[model samples]
Target: MDFGVAAEDEAFRVEARGWLGEHVGAVTERRAWERALGAGGWIGLGWGEGGYGNRTASLTQQVVWAEEYARAGAPPRCGHIGEKLLAPTLVAHGTAEQKARFLPPIAAGDELWCQGYSEPGAGSDLAGVRTRAVREGASYRITGQKIWTSLAHEADWCFVLARSEAGTRRHQGLSFLLVPMDQPGRIEVRPIRQMTGTSDFNEVFFDGAYARVEHVVGGEGNGWRVAMSLLGFERGVSTLAQQTGFAQELARVVRTARETGAVRDPVVRDGLVRLWAELRVMRWNALRTLGSTGDAGAPSVAKLLWGGWHQRLGELAVRVRGAAGGVGPVAWSASAPYEMDADQHLFLFSRADTIYGGSDEVQRTIIAERVLGLPLEPKGDMG
Candidate 1:
């Protein structure tokens, strides 16, 4: 529980800072950041050129990389699904051949990956997914629709959960398959623009998509386990990077408000104080989850708390920005775009924070039943 970094970790942090200073530059554009990651190995910092990462490095080292990258004004690596969720999952569950085929491009940022977990019918209730993949000779013909697929429109591949066996329990008979997005007659993707007017998420359609049997990660009927493992990583490590970025943005917002004299107002001061307190709590909570004594249930709680705070912070930013908070084109300046200002765009996007990954209500249910050992909520009959 020592929050202080060890001497070794300090050295690692110094080295990481030096490396980032040399290779990374301030890039406010998200696309430019992605390209920078590809050019540098910063995107998959600890990961090997192949599927493995520097296992010798402590978790503290990974945190160092994340923090230093953020300080350098580089977008955190979690912005891409390949580095955040898919790579680690692949390292754990992918076959040797599968790893050989996929890992390099992801490490190099030559390929992008997206998650095809949520559907029109199944989101928080992931086990209820109705997407089907029938076995056909040496391949599986996948046919289903996925929604909330972030970056699917630009992704080179997707890790999808499909019902490989029908008529079984919702959780059972599922498999995790890797489908190539460029393959013909197999996939269609349409962008789902948010209120922010940016299409970061998409609706992906799989029409008899052909995937080789070897494309399955882990194994058939083991998708539930693999997916659970992946979600654990998603909630833990992935969420850590995101919270770091949020905290950075929070700091930036505070500075902006102060410079603009918005902080002089009582209401603005109160909002900033509240946000600061919440940010501290979030950082501590996230550290606990990412630390050695981290618990499985901690992430569920962290996600819930962090997501709510993100939304609140965005609201506070909007209030601070006033008329400037409105979404529209902005005149270019040397600094960050006013249109891309934290309060407006972030506030709009925060609306979906609780909805994506897992809803706040869903996380609370998990904490209640699983963590607190409470009685399960009564289910409504669809029949």
Candidate 2:
């Protein structure tokens, strides 16, 4: 339960911080930074043997690297889903050939990946997935739609969950396939414009898209197991890094409050104090939960904690801005419509925090049934 960073980890922190400070820059500059990080052997740091990671690295050292990367103000990592989620899963379940082909490119930052888990009908209830994959001679022809796919337009590949068996329902019959996105005309990506007026998320369509037999991970009909493993990776060491950005946002709100005299309001002052305290609690909880590797309930708890905390922080940010929060540019025109300040963007985008990924309701149910051993919630008859 000791949370202290040891001396060796402190040295590693210095190295990580210095490297990120020198290389980190804007989103447009991320590819070069990613390449630089890859060249430095900082991309994949935990895959055992023959992989590019320092397999000897301890959990504390990993946490140190993540913390320093975020504290240095590095651009939100573009290669995160690949390095953190997919690579580890491949190391655990993928075939030898699959690992050899995909791991190197991902470690080198030459490829990016996205998850195609959510669909129009099967979001939080992933067992309800209707996207079907029909087996052809040597490949599977994938035909379905996926919604709220983050970075779909920018990804080189997607690991999709599609039903491989016709008669199966819920989690049975699903398969995890790694499909390439460069297919002409068969694949389409249309951005979902956020309230921020930017489209980082996308609606992706696969009409007769294909993945070779070799691309299936964890074997066919075992996709639920593999998909759940990947979700566990989603809450890995990267969570510590993400909180650094949250820390920055909180600091901004505090500074604004002091400048705008909002600090004089007792209510505003108390609210800021509570937020600061809760953030510290969150960091400690993350540190504690990191050791419980593969715990199904821990990720959901982490998600619920941060999702609600962030949404509340967004509200605090607007309140501190006082009247100026509503006074931003309003003309919705080709010239300059949808322009929003940092506070405005935070407020609007945070609205979806509880809705995306797994909704708050879904996370609570997971905690209740899985963690507490409670009875399953009854579902309506679809008959």
Score candidate 2 by lDDT.
0.84
User: TM-score of model 1 relative to the true fold?
Assistant: 0.87
lDDT tens string, model 2, 1-383?
A: 67788886887888877777776763357676667777877878767676645344677878888888878777777788888889989988999899999998888888999889898877778888878899998999999999999888889999999999998988789999999999989899999997788999899999999999999999999999999888878887888887888999999999988888888889998989998998999899998888686576988888999999999988888887763445432324567668777887888888898988799999999999998999999865321
What is the number of residue pairs that collide in model 1? Answer: 0
Best by lDDT: 2
lDDT tens digits by residue: candidate 1, 145-189: 999998887787899999998776677899999988997667988
Q: Which stretches of model 1 miss by more than 4 angstroms?
A: 26-40, 43-51, 54-56, 76-79, 291-294, 323-340, 379-383
Pairs of residues clashing in candidate 1: none
